[model samples]
Target: MTLLELLDYASVFVFALTGALVASRAQLDIVGFAFVAALTATGGGTVRDVILDRNPVFWVAEPGFIAVAVAASAVVFFSAHLLESRLRVLTWLDALALAVAVPAGTGVAMTLGHGAAVVLLMGVATGCLGGLMRDVVCNEVPLVLKQGELYVTAAFAGAAAALVAAQVMPQGAALLVCAAVTLVLRAGSLLFGWQLPVYRSRPPRR
Candidate 1:
């Protein structure tokens, strides 16, 4: 498989794991786990592909993507109970997914000859949208909407890095750098409790 394709599959597995973890936390059944897992695995890439006018969404073009997601759901379904902290696993898995998905999206956009702006946006969408959908479906606060979270910012930084790196390096190297930047920023936030500053509203006039 091509590096980009490999990254896509890896992201699918990681995102599906996070989705299954959410289902586990919600006490959902096996079907719920599979549904959410599949949605989270492919939602972002589907959105990106649609926007880019790429006929036959990535998962549709390669049914193996769906198979991988289903397999991930099954693995989590049978193994989640052994985890001492599902939340922690979900957080890390989400971070890893973001790292992989950002580069995957950026690489596709570049390959399609899109401008840097579109490339960056596609990267961010592919990294964030799936998790957002998962959280909304699970009735949890979506990480992107949470105050002070660096999720989207990290995605932006990674996408920008990939765009810049692609100008001077091979696509594979650029993708690696993108993933590394995203993973470091996200993991650092999780480890150090780093967050953006929240806006303060002025008092209402009397």
Candidate 2:
């Protein structure tokens, strides 16, 4: 399996797990779990493929991705109750998914001979869109747009890191740097409360 494919699978499974957990929290049934899981798992990558005009979208090319998402949903459907803090687990797992996914998108753009701008945008889209879809579908606050969160910023930074590292290293190593930087930034936001400054709309002129 190529690195991009591997990253796709990894991110799909992880993102699916987060989706299932969300479904559980929403008290949804097994079918609902599967639907949400599959959506969250493939949403971002599907968008990436579509935008790049890749003939068959990743999951459409290989249905195994959908199966993997269903399997993840099944696992969480039966076990979500054991965790006292499903939200915490879901957050970290989403962070992991983001990290893996960003590299997948970046690698694809690079392989297709795209410039840095496309590569960077693809990376951010692949990492953030899945979770955004998941949250919106589940009627939860989209973490991507949460106040001052590092989610999108982290993906942008990670993609930038990969672009720079690609000049001095192999594709595989550059992607690893991408994942590491993404995970660290996202984890810091979740664990250490790292935040960006938010806009405050003050009353116009006194």
Candidate 3:
């Protein structure tokens, strides 16, 4: 497989793991776990492909993607307790996912001759939407909606950087740099509790 395709598979694996982790925490059954895992693993990429008008979504073209997700869910189902304390795995995995997915999404868009704006937006959708689905399925406030560290914002920033860098550097190098930037920024946000300020509305007339 090409480097970008490899990165896409890696991102899918991490997303699958994250979905299984959440489902295990919720004490979901096997079917539910697999459902959530598959959704979280492919939802963002599916959306990105649709937005970019890329026919034949990745998972549809490659049944192996779904197989990997299902396998990941099975692994988590049986060994979840062993991974509880390392639940922080999700945060790190999220960082890696952002790194791999945003660049892959942007690369695909660029390859399709899309403008930079469209490419960047595709990258953001690719990186964030799966996690959004996962959070909603788990009944948690989505990270993008919360007063958490710049999640989607960070992904957009990295994607933009990648798209710009592609002008000068080789595709692989540009992708690596952008992914590294994303990983560093996101991991720092998690480690430092970095969060964007929230705007709260006061109650009106009593």
TM-score of each: 0.95, 0.96, 0.90
Model 2, C-alpha of 14: deviation from truth (Å) = 0.3
What lDDT tens digits, residue by residue, belong to model 3 across residues 133-195?
A: 998979967765557687877788888888878889888788887787777778778888765
Would you give me the overall lDDT of model 2?
Answer: 0.94
Q: Rank the candidates by lDDT, best first.
A: 2, 1, 3
Question: What are the lDDT scores of the predictions, listed in order?
Answer: 0.92, 0.94, 0.82
Candidates' RMSD to native: 2.3, 1.9, 3.1
Alpha carbon lDDT of residue 65, candidate 1?
Answer: 95
Q: Which tens-of-lDDT digit does each residue in 69-105 have in candidate 2?
A: 9999999999988998998899889999999999999
User: Which candidate, 1 or 3, has the higher TM-score?
Assistant: 1
- Any residue pairs clashing in model 1, and if so which? none
The candidate that achieves the highest lDDT relative to the unseen native structure? 2
Lowest lDDT 10-residue stretch of candidate 1: 195-204
lDDT for predicted candidate 1 compared with the true structure? 0.92
Count the clashes in each prediction.
0, 0, 0
- Of the two candidates 1 and 2, the one with more favorable TM-score, higher being better, is 2
